[model samples]
Target: MAEPTMRALLRRRDLGLRLVSEEDALPADALDRPLRWVHSSDLADPTPFLSEDLALLTTGTQFDGLDGADGYTGYVQRLSGRGVLGLGFGTEVHRSGIPDELVSACAASGMPLFEVPYRTPFIAVARAHSEAIAAEAYARRSWALDTQRALALAALRPRGLDATLAELGRRLGVWAGMFDATGALQSSHPQEAIAPEVLALLGDRVIDVLTRGLEAGQSLAIGAHPFMLFTVGRGGQLRGVIALAIDALDPEARTVVTSVIAMAGLALEQSEQLARSRRRLHTQLLSSLQTDDPALARRVLGSIPPAPVVVAVAADAPVGPLSDWWERLRAEGGAASFVAESPEGVVMCVSADDEGLLDQAAERFGIRIGISEPESYSAFSRAHSQALAALRQESSGAYRYADTVGASILSALATDEARLVAESRLAPLRDHDTSTGADLERSLRTWLEHDARAEPAAAALGVHRHTLRSRIAQAGALLAMDLSTFPARAEAWTLLQTARD
Candidate 1:
């Protein structure tokens, strides 16, 4: 509720207050100055005892001995300097009317001066203002209650979060906006109400608050506009922030904003829950596709990314922001894509034509992504494997399967299946060495490393050339490979590298 203004007091008929000072002499907004209370003091110097924003009601007693304009001018100046809103003189009490010297002094000083008829006591004028203040307070409380009800109803709309925010902005007569966890604007009421520079400043403040990972509110001003920002979720798990373009809020208006914040938090929490459920469903669908059954996935999910899609795997990515991004994409009727959480990390499959989407996600989330070559849905599992391999080679940004093809053959063979095969192929020699203490596997590996040269291979093994040759022949017998041939030597060298990797 607004404090009672002097103009409101003059409008009260029962008070019988009349402005005696020339209206032209007063400041244009003099009558509209808010009055804290009305005070009556006849002391020659009432400035020491009076507070600001109040009317000093006098009965002319202070002017009884005043004989010069200097005294009157000093008195009016003191009152004005003390921040008194105006002066009210009780007429027909100590004098027949207001002293001419006092009226001239008030007009010269640009102080509002009024006459209170003796019939209407100073107490009556004070009571009128008190009642006005009370009535305004009551009206504001009623408005607050009604606005809260309207906001609650708005929360029941189809798009409850957006509706609630719009209603809040309308009710408070200010712009309202919501920023996502990523510090990006998610929704705003009266869109485009904020200038670009101010919006950028707001975004910076929002990010600062979010980075603190706390549940708190901030009050700040950008240029001429003031804003109040509040985090919309629990501490350490903030979902987003709500910003109101308001300088200050009365208690009632603050209560209304609190209600809207609660509603928005609940809506966002519900959205997070729904996103999690949808992600789980997507994970299941992706699992079906991984089993080489795109039809089953299609039957459950209605559709999947078209054939000849690139599978991408991302590591150390924040799930909330990415999930929110995906939800926005679906809302905008963008291309269908499959995304899911995996033991490796987050996996996504998009049409090869939409490969830029992966780059966008990578840039937005600061995550490293590895993408596979284009392949049909029937080869989903293979593409997935290729994506995993690409991910192993990725240091940052998006690494594609095609890029890995030119990498070292040793790196290419560094897979779980390759390691298993390599280990199995050399296991017989390992078993023979373990049983008889014959270092056959070591001899064969050393011989392959030295290009099958008997002297250097034996010297490196710290054994005689004849003994090294015998160990290699024994290893060859156990592995069923001819040790002297280039094919056998190359295969042995490849297996050693694969096993080491």
Candidate 2:
């Protein structure tokens, strides 16, 4: 806050510069202007080289050959227009004393004029002002460094992001909020001060910021609040944004804000690194579960449950916060519950008792879940298939448990088992064929294929209609199972198809 101003520089007694303008002419407010630099330009037109808020020093040599006071007045007018803090005139070289024309012009134009004594060199004043500016800059930088360290420490605490944002809001004396890559609000301090519209605006602008690579801090207004948007990232790769409702136009304040931005970037990187590590672990666990080696799967899972395990699959839903789902499952299944990604969507492995948690997650995230029957670790592959089948059958907003009986049960059976079941159901015909060299199995398949129509079945079989009917009757008698009911026919048909598949 202690900046180098024109009045402060003039109060230094070492330079021996005298105030030439009247006390009434130079108001206290005029001396309070912040001095950017001390420039010594003897040129008549130094406006091109000069910038605003600078103290300009000269020897009055530019006006020596001019005839009238207009030249001197014109020089003063140009200096005033260029925002010169004040004019320092050396009296020894160009004339005997300060020129009356220049003094009258300074008074008339209301430009502060001071006389630089013959003993003091312009270089000395320039060095003094430069040193003062450097000191103020160093002070601000040191303060900013301390603040950054404090913020980093705060970020290490429990609920760290919230703590860090709270500390930042307190430091900047404004509402501060942090957002994730998805523009989800992660944390905020003085939360009530942030209007809902401001968060919406933040979400809207983050897309533009990311797409256009607007990584720099931008000042924008949202409803009643003037917000400062800082994209948090490194090397032009954005991870998140930090919004502050503070007027950070001051150079020192901006430096502090820059430090905060850097901290936010580091925090985001750390969080993302942790997430990547977790994902890698989850993928490894999923791979182990899918492998044929039960030993390796057991090793990866750390333990095998005495109770049967069920796998629940939730696919093609509007993906919600993964952390919420994970926490929900852990709440029911303890730490042993695993949530991971599947080719279809997200997959969860939990005990049968905790399978219902998948229903809660599906309902909350607007997804449909499929729960597989309880199975051991060795049958995880089968359970996964069952869950996928259940998920495929679900046509509404609720979860569906994989059926363990009837035609739906065929989906969970291995190809070999399906073939065995199909052959066993028609074993009597096969045994009879072995003894008598008959084709009743083929005849039965043909009859079922033609929907029990004797004419079409006989034509497809290249046999007489009476012969096909006699073969079908013989097979039904040999099998000793009812073939008239829909359920019996459907079961036979499903088993046969399972065998073919």
The best candidate by TM-score is 1
Best by lDDT: 1
User: What is the lDDT for 432 in model 2?
Assistant: 92
Q: Please give the range of 10 consecutive residues that has the lowest summed lDDT in model 2.
A: 318-327
Residues 1-501 of candidate 2: C-alpha lDDT, one tens digit per residue: 568987777887999878888858776667788899999978999999989999999998788688889998898999999999789988786677888999999988777888888888999989989989999889887877777787888878986777888888887788888876555666788888876876787778865776576787888876667888888875456777888887555675677667777777777677667766665676677777876345764666576434488887777753334543464335566645666775777777777776666666676566777778888887888888778777766365444554535544555553566678777876777789889998887888888999988999999999999999888778778877577767777776776666652
What candidate 1 gets wrong by more than 4 Å, as runs, is 1-3, 22-28, 64-74, 99-110, 196-201, 411-501
Q: Over the stretch 25-62, how does candidate 1's per-residue lDDT look in tens digits? A: 78998988778888899999988899988988999887
List TM-scores for all candidates, in order: 0.79, 0.53
Worst 10 residues of 1 by lDDT: 322-331
Q: lDDT of all the models against the reference?
A: 0.87, 0.76
